[model samples]
Target: MLYLSQFIKMLLIVVIMLQWINPAQAADLTVSLSDNQGNPLPNIVVTLTSPATIIEEAEFSPQHPAIMDQIDRQFVPHILVVPKGSYVAFPNSDSIQHHVYSFSKAKPFELKLYSGRPPQPLEFGQAGEVAMGCNIHDWMLGYVYVVDTPYYGKTNARGQLTLTVPPDDYQLILWSPLLDSKDSAVQYSVDVAADSKIDLSLKHALLPAFEGFEQSDEFDDY
Candidate 1:
């Protein structure tokens, strides 16, 4: 009888240990974005940065090159989020030539008229927004958001993004090309001790939507 009692005590201790360790594992942060009308807003860039998570330039490692393809005279993704110091390839899949350039202060360079992929990918060394445009196609516009942290992603069709991050206090930032100049981004202080969800709405109405390639008169010319 004593032996069985001791075995039960050991099992209880082990179970208690597991319950304590489970909370230390990474947790998910579900963020849902909406516009003024409460309609789900997609393509919004979301980033979570902790004050303790300071990244050094020497520790920055570039992941697989990101692709910003030109298809049917429009940027495949209207907005892209990339980590700082990462490379982005501008591949022109269309038959016609494309000159992709960004005047944004983050990374400014011009890819003169070209049909195929550029010889090399351009590196985004700064952390800011890079607005791209095609010299030949005036209405064509796109944005590349460069962030310093890896905990970043764009909202999907459902206007929701899930990020797995260690338990910490983070500053959640949201940005979109459609955001008004006066209110470019929305930010909040989030304390994530476990799986958490946040619902955010834009303070101001978004700017008019960009003209798609199909909607432009230039579509028939090419």
Candidate 2:
């Protein structure tokens, strides 16, 4: 009985130690973005993709729809990042109606004039940037970046994003609508083990924000 009790205690200790050394513990990856002028660039989408991350698994799994809201004639987020095959709802919170549409090749669709949430969300089946604008309010511009990987985030006001992911080798990708079409996506090879940080600077100055559509009397009737 004494030997059995000792064996049980040893087993308990081993179990506790094993739990402390769990390989599933998530690691933090900090990504910092800056423009060529060394100023923090916010609203940039960052994604991490690895061989272990199955795109099909993420596509099949149901995810809560993301919202691209309009308030005061502008897209609240300006840039939204979502996993490929996810749905995005355009909710108009402003008093005025908004007609949101995207001409980008990734996803091309339009939400006719509406004042509230649409009945259904639109799915972004492809992995690319969707540049959106309001047909009625030409100045209103926004973007949706759809990525194949499930691990993604957007930079905050300070141009910093932290992602918790399993330790593995991954390809880090960054995207922004302001970037030129040819250089929109920047990729880097990263191996994440323990907590790590990466700093990236844009090669060129970002394009100026869309001010407004060319003034024309064609729409003077509203």
Question: Highest TM-score: which candidate?
Answer: 1
TM-score per candidate: 0.82, 0.78
Model 2 quality (TM-score)? 0.78
- The list of candidate 1 runs beyond 4 A from truth reads 1-24, 54-63, 212-214, 217-222
Q: Write one digit per residue (lDDT tens) for candidate 2, span 1-222.
A: 999999999999998899889946689999999988999988878889998986654333234578888877778677888788888877688767778888899999988756654547788889988988888876777888889888988888999999999899999987876776555655688999989999988888889865453232334326
List pairs with backbone clashes in candidate 1.
Answer: none
lDDT string for model 1 (141-178, tens) is 88888998888888889899999998999999887777
Cα deviation of 14, candidate 1, in Å? 10
Worst 10 residues of 1 by lDDT: 54-63
Model 2 weakest 10-residue run by lDDT: 212-221
